[model samples]
Target: MRLSNLIPSIPANVVACLEVQGIRTDTDLLFSTTTFDIYKRLPAGTATLEELTEYTTIAAEIGAAPGMSGHELLLLENTYGDVQLRTGNAELDGLLRGLDGRWIIELSGDKGSGKSTVALNLLINHLASNLEDTALWIDTTCDFSPERATQFLDATQTLPSTLERLQVSLAFDIDTIQGILETLSRPNDPRARPRFLVIDTITPLLGPLLSAVSAQGHAIMTDFMRQLQTFAQASGTAVFVINNSSRKGRDTPERKPALGPSFALLTDTTLWLEAKNDNNTEDSTEDNTVHTMQILKSRSAPIGGCCTFRIHGNVICPT
Candidate 1:
């Protein structure tokens, strides 16, 4: 049903603004992010907060009517539902429980810990399994190596076009990421919805905002996380964020995610990586280096599970 159908109930100007945002049908309004977010994007006088909330509520009810799955309602054919992503290494998959479901996961560690390698492995393996599926990589720190990704795809022996299905974007700030999330939230978007989403090294984007004197930083961080969660839940996109580790205190050995506890609490799981051998050694090759992945927290698996793996060429081998 078109937004114009509800014109008498909803303000005409409000519908016009929503249409400007590409919300033409009831499903579009229903799947778009929260009412407050939409309100903020609209012209100042277009819609009040209460008005948007009410309008969205109406859209939701209509969209949720009996016998209508979200995919059916939105006319989004062939959309992927909850899925278990694998890295093709049996031991690692067993350790991660196949990295199942649509949830937010964090992969964090010091440099050379093999976080990006493992993440890229996941993306390659998932895309290779089904050429029709797509994934997203948000390169916040400009660390996404296209050459490395190509090498991984070549190792899998999949067609060259498999790499084409992985959508990559360089977004170094909160606003850019927010815009990306909003675009993914739109039901009418032209690009295929990604089954997996990665934000590599979130530290650079969020690290500077966290300060001793400002609560606003925390609020902004929280909002960004919430928006990510909203997108994950709404779209069934398995989200992975690459994070960096930091010392818990001034002089202690205890380590925590650099984004702190607030960010940790928002994610469904967290995995910490550590390089057992220095891959930087002139004598060491990728085959000889070992990395350990430790699950610090999880909702689907045990909290202390650990797996050891090595990067040989572009493939992850369980050691």
Candidate 2:
């Protein structure tokens, strides 16, 4: 079943792939056995990957020598690298950033909270990091504004040319957004890795759509969210969603409500952004901002902290 001899020109990642997939021996069955699942299960553990180069080199050589199909040659090259994946965000840098693969980051708070601004800030960060990177902004309420793009960078007091590079597919509904994400998540497509994805709010995907179609609409929204999760997981891109805080009971304490149970279950991190009580507009003057932060949940680290931020000119600046 060994393909290494036949694909002697392969890279180590390929050779190691074949060997680990039980393809180390010569046989017709090797082709059948070395399927998608076999390659998917290939361990990318540090120690195991260290020796991939030597083996992949041998296999790739054979693939290159002559009669291999382009598709077959592609597989050899595609599967043969030590890919250092990136999250394309500064706040969630290092291992915690893109590790979750299909991470859902939710920003939830009452009205006037800077949740949307913070999400936009990340969107800018994604663009600043890579000009080629794309971002999707799903505007359920028609609130997405290019004019407001400068607001997220307000602290800088100046807008840069790169800000215009924040590519977006403005989706007015859940289904529209769902369709766009599906196209972006297809494997082997260069457009799959957008810099950031923003769901302005999940309510439009749930309530409004559900009311019109009843239970069926609710089910469709649910499926759409699942698809979002799948897209995030496979592409290793960031998923950001703004959520409206649930209403509090009349007699209930002003304490904030936990986000939807399902949100906590699916997102890698959940952050709450709420402004402090405005004692006076001019009195606080710590750059005239008073946004507070709390890590509602974090799988990568201790989900805890407080951060003060404000929109100086148009952007959210950490104070």
Error of 2 at 131 (Å): 2.9
Which pairs clash inside model 1? none
Q: What is the lDDT of candidate 1?
A: 0.79
Worst 10 residues of 1 by lDDT: 60-69
- Measured against the true structure, the TM-scores of the candidates, in listed sequence, are 0.75, 0.61
Error of 1 at 306 (Å): 0.5
Which parts of model 1 are misplaced by more than 4 Å?
Answer: 1-79, 188-191, 278-283, 286-288
Task: Report the Cα lDDT for residue 148, model 2.
Answer: 73
The true-versus-predicted C-alpha distance at residue 148 of model 2, in Å, is: 2.0
Residue lDDT tens for model 2, 81-103: 21222323234333233333346
Prediction RMSDs, each to the true structure: 7.2, 14.4
